[model samples]
Target: MAMRVVDAAAAAIAALLGFVLALPFCLAAPSITTHGSDGGGGSYVSAVGDPGMRRDGLHVAWEAWNFCNEVGREAPGMGSPRGADCFDLENGVDENGQPTYKVVHRVTDADNNLRAGDPLPGSPANITDVDLYAAAKELYLGDRCQVPDSPSPWQFWMVMLKNGNLDTTAAICPENGRPARPFSQTSRFPCPGGAGCMNQPLVFHNRTALDATGRRLRGGLFGTYDLDAADLGSKEVSYYSVTWEKDLGSGGWVFHHKLRTAPKYPWLMLYLRSDATKGFSGGYHYDTRGMTKMVPESPNFKVRVTLEVKQGGGPNSQFYLMDMGSCWKNDGRPCDGDTATDVTRYSEMIINPETPSWCTRRRIEECPPWHTFRNGTRVHRTDAARFPYAAYHVYCSPGNARAAEQPTTYCDAYSNPQPQEILQLVPHPVWGEFGYPTAKGQGWIGDPRTWELDVGALSQALYFYQDPGTPPAKRKWSSLDVGTEIYVSKYAEAEWTLSGFDIVVPEDCVGSSQGGPLVPEFLILCDETLILEIPNQRVPISRGEEEQGKVTHTHEGCLEEVAAGEHLVGGRELAEIPDPAPDLGDAVAAGAQHDEHGGGDRLDHDGAAPALGAVDGEQREASERRAEEQHEHQRRLRGQQREEQLDHGCGGESVDPSNRWWARRRRRKWGRRDVGSGGISRRAIWGDGIRSSRSESSRRIHNGRLLEAVLGASSF
Candidate 1:
C-alpha cells in the first residue's frame, strides 16, 4: 500500500489566501462535446495566441563547464569557458510601407577572448581571479548582449556545453559540498587516459550578421576540444555547434543545435536553458545572467514548445523534452548561498521511448515512495498492479537526504557542484493524461509537434524529500530546459531545432476566483527565452529555468485534464454550468498584438477584447466597468453552467476518486469541447497513465499542488 496524499501542502496556503475553491452542486452539468471553432481546440493555455516563432532577432552564446563547473585549464588559449555572438534587428520602413530589418552585432571577439589576468577596461584590479574572471567575463558579455525592455532587462539565450569526464584523482570537484577529496574510482568516472583530460574547449564564435543570402539574419558558435588533434573522425573526436537564424523582423528565432561525442569527451552534454536573471541556476554556484527572469513553481505552470529533430544521436544520448532544475535545502527551505546544504534538484521528461526504466515494481530504489493520483489518492511504489514502472527512467535522491526512506538511490556526487536529486520520466501511457506523446516515435525525427504540458501539476505530485516537520519545500523551480547529455557514447551526434517555447504562470490572483488582473505572458520582456525572475516581479534569469526553460527531445519522455460541467442545483434541471467560466487559459497563445503599451490587455482577435479590457483611451474607466461587468457575467455564467450540468447525465458532489481526480483525470466518452478564448480547449497539466507491458492501458490520476486554481479531478 502506498502512502495517500490528499491535496498538496500549497493548497492550504492557497485557500487561506482568500481564493475560493468552488465545488460543484449535486447535479452535474451537460456533457461537453463540442468541437472547437478552429475545427480543433488547442492547448487551453497555449491557444491564447501562440507567438509561434516571431523574429526577436538572433541572440546566441555558448559556455563549457568542467566537473566543478569551473574552466579548468581553459583549453590552452581558448580563453575562459565562455563566448557569445548576439545581435538585434532594426526594421526600417520603406517609402512603400514595406519593412526591412538589419542585423545589429553587439559583441566582439575582443570581448570574448579577454582573460582573467588582463585588465578590464572599466574595472579595478581587486576582483581578479579565475572564478571572478569567469564571472566578469559573463558580465562583460552581458554588457554587449543586454537588451532593455519594460518590466526587467535581459540577455541572449545560452548554448551550454559540458564535459562529464572528471579526474577524481585531481580533486577538482567538491564532495557533498565539502572540499574535493581523493576518491578511488574506476569506469564510473569517465576518463580518456591522461591526467589533464578534464579541460575546456577551443570555442569559436561567428558574430551575428546577415548571412550571404542577405534575406535572413544568422550567426553561430562552433568548437572542438581535441585541441592538437586535427585528424579526428566525426565520431572519434568531439564537436558541437549551434547556429541561429531568423528572417529579418519576421519569424521567431530558430536555434539549431548539433553536439557530437568523441572517444575522450564521450559524455559531453548540451542544452538550451532559461535560467534566473540574477540568482543561481541549476548546477551553478554563482549569480548568473540568463533568459528567464521570473522563476516558475511546480503544479502552477504550463510549458509550450515545438521541437524537430534532424538527427538522433545514438542510443546513449539522453535527450530531454523538458528538464526542470531547482534548488532548496533538504529541510524544505529556499536555497541560499550554501553549496554544502543546498541541493540542485531536477525533474526531467526524457523522450527517448527506447530508454529503459531503471525503476520497476521490483526496483523500488529507482522510483519515488508513492505516486499521487489525479483524485488525490496515493499508490505506493510497491503497488505492482497500479504503479507504472515504465514511465520512470530513474529516480535518484539527494546525497544530503538525512532520513531518505530506506529504498532510495542517491544521485551522482561528481556530476554537480552540490548534491542533487533527479527524477527522470519517459513517454508512456502513464503520461498521456498530461497531453504528452503516448507512444514511442510520436515526435521523433519525422514527427514534429507543438506540445502543451502541465509541468506545474505533475511536478507537485512527484516526491521530493522534506524534513519531518518542515513546511514542504516550495518547489520553486529555477531552471527549465531541453537538451541532451550523451552519457559516454562515442561518436554520438544529436541534432535538433527548437523554437516557439514558453512557460506560463497564469495571471490568476493567488487564490481568489478573480480574473482579468494578470497581464498575458510573453516570450520575454528581456527578449530572450531564458528568464531569471526576482520571485514575484516576473523578471527573467540567465540560468533561466525558474521562469524560462528550453524545449527538447531525448533520443526520452513527457508532461497534463478537465471540461464542460453540469449540475442539478435546487433540484432544477440543468444543461450546463450556466456561463460558468472554465478556469483555463493560463497564458497561452500570446502574441505581438498583446498590448506592448501596458503588458496588459491581450488581443488574440477582435472578440478577445470583450473578455479582456482594452488599453486605449478611457482605458481605466473601461477596465473598471469591464471588471464589474465580468463579475456579474461570470455569476450568471456559473449558474448557467450549473444548470447545464443537471441536463447532462453526470453529477455527484461528494467527489469520486475513480470518476475524476482533483487536479487531473477528466474524461469524455464523447469528443473534445472548447474551453477558452482563441480556439483554446480544456487541457490537463501534469498527468499519467499506466499500461502494463503491452497490456490494457489504465489512466492513473496524479494530484499535487501543481495548479493554483481548481481544474477539478478528471484531469490527466
Candidate 2:
C-alpha cells in the first residue's frame, strides 16, 4: 500500500509537469538560433568570437608525454616533445613598390633545441632539475606567444602529444609520486618492446613567414617517434604535422593537423587545447599557463567554435567536438593543490559517427545510473528502452567514486594526472537541444559550421555522481578544447582543421552568479553588473484546454499518443519549488509517512507508475489542480513582497510590474529558462518537444521522460 501511494504521488507530480509542457510541443521545439547577449559575466574565455574566421596572434605551444602524461625520454636529439612557433605579422608596404611587412618569430632555434641537462638562459632559482627544463621550455614558448598591452599578460594555445606506451620492465614511472616496483607484462598495458618503446618524438619546426601569395602566410611543426628511422623527407614511418596558415588581408588563421601511426609507435594522441593563463590545467599537476584567463563555472557559459574533420582516424580515434576540463576536491571544496584529493572531471562530445557506444546493458559500469533530460527529470539506466544508448560513447567513473553504483567501470588511470571521470556524449538527438549536431557527420569534413552551444545549460543536465551525503561540487571547468586523441593503431592517419574558438557567458549571470574557488589572478574588474538575483515567480496563463484550466493545440494526421488531461503536482513535490540547496540527494525517499500522502492510496496503474504517466486525459485533471496551485504560489509570493515593502515603506519605494518584467526579460536574455515541474516553465523543459514524433523518436534526447511521451517520442 505504501509503495502504491509513493507511485501515485509521483504520477500526480508528473501529470502536472505534463500540462505545463503541452504548449511547447504544439509550438514546435525551440530552434538553435542566436540570442543577443551583453558581455557581463565572470569568464576568461577565448579571444575570438567569430565562428567563420580563424583568428591569429594566437599563442599555441606543444608538449609530448609518455603513457603516464610524462616525458619518458627525449627522442634522440629532441630535447622534449614540447615546443612552439608563435609570431606576429605586421602589414605594410615596402619602400619601393610591393606590399611587405616584417612578420617576426619570437622563439629561437636554440630555445627549441635545448636538451634535458642544458641550463636555460635565465633559469629561475626555484627550478632545479627536470622542473627547470620544463619551465624554461614553457617560458621560451611564452616569450613567443606573449600578447602585450593588457594588464594581465597571456600565452599561446597548447598542442599536446602523448605516446601510450609504458615501459613496465623498466618501471620508470613512479606509483602515485613514489617509486614503482618492477613488474612483468600481463597482456594489459601496451609496452611492446623493451627500453626504446617509450621514447619521445624527434621534433622539427618551420617558422612562419609571408608566402609568395604575398597575401598568405604559413608555418608548421612536425615530428616522428621512430628515432633511428630516416623518414623526415617523407611520412612513410610514424609522423605528425600541424601547419597553420592564414591570408594576411583576410580571415582568422587556420590550423591544419595531420597524424599518422607507425608500427613502433602504434598508439598516439594529439590535441589542441585552450589551457589556463596561469594555473594548473585539467591534467597538469603544475602551475600552468593557458587561454582561459578566467575559468567559467557550471550552468553559466557556452562555447562557440567551428570544426571540420576530414578523416576519422580508424576505430580507436576519440575525436572530441568539444571537451570540457575541470578540477575539484571530492569533498566539494575547491582544489587547493592537493594531488591525492583533487580530481579531474571531463565531459566530451565524441563526434566519430562510426564510434560504437560501449555503454550497453551488459556494460552498466560504463553508464551512469541515470541520464538527465534537458528538463530536470531523470531516467534510470535500467529503463533500457528510455536511456539514450547510441547517444553516448561511454561514461567512466572518477577513480575515486567510493560508493559508485554497483558494477561500475572506472576511467583509464594511466592517462590523467590524478583519478579522472569521463562523460563521453555522442552525436545523437539527445544533444540537439543544446544546438549540437543532431546527426552523424553534421559538422565533419564536407560540412563546416558556426555552433552556438548552451554548454552551461546542457552541462547542468548531465550526470556527475557523488556520495549521497556529500555537497554538490561546483562544476568549475579549468580547460575547454577541441581535438582528437588517435589511439595506437598502425598504418593509419587522421586530419582536420579548427578555427574561431570562443567561450561565452550570459551577460546577466556573471560575477557572483557562477560560483567557484576564488583565484585572485582571474578576476580583475570584478564587475557587479553581471550579478543576477533570480526571484522565483510563476507566471499563470491559461495554455492547454480552458474549462480544464489548460491550453494547447494539435497537429493534423499525427501518430496517436496518450490523451492530455488534468492532474497536477501535489505532496512533497511542491516543497521548495525553486533552487533548493545543492546538497539535496537525488535518491528517492523510500516511503511516505501518515499525513504525507496526497489524499488516498494510489496505483502503479500500468508497467510504469501512473503519476509519472504525465500524458492522457489525466493531464486534464492535473490542469485543474495546477491552476489552483499557481494562484496560491503567486499569492504567497506577492504577500511576502508586500510585507518586505511595508518594512521599508519609510523609503517611499515600491516593486513595480515593469521592474519584474525587466528582470524576467534579462533571465530570458541569458538563456536561463528554469525548467522544472515545481517552478520553471513547461516551454523550458520541452525544448525538443516540437519535433514530430517520428523525428524525435529517431534521435535520443535528455528532456525528461514526460517530454518524450508528450512529444510522442521514444528513447534508447
Error of 1 at 544 (Å): 43
Which 10 successive residues of model 2 have the least lDDT summed?
Answer: 523-532
Residue 385 of model 2, lDDT score: 81
The CA-based lDDT of model 2 is what?
A: 0.53
Full-model lDDT, candidate 1? 0.55
lDDT of 1 by residue, 348-430 (tens): 88886557888998889998766655334556688899988878889887888776766788988777878888888888886
Worst-scoring 10-residue span by lDDT in model 1: 552-561
Q: What is the C-alpha RMSD of each candidate to the true structure, in Å?
A: 18.0, 17.2
Q: How do all models score by TM-score? A: 0.66, 0.65
Superposed by TM-score, candidate 2 places the C-alpha of residue 340 at a distance from the truth, in angstroms, of 1.8
- List per-prediction Cα lDDT, in the order shown: 0.55, 0.53
Candidate 1 TM-score over all chains jointly: 0.66
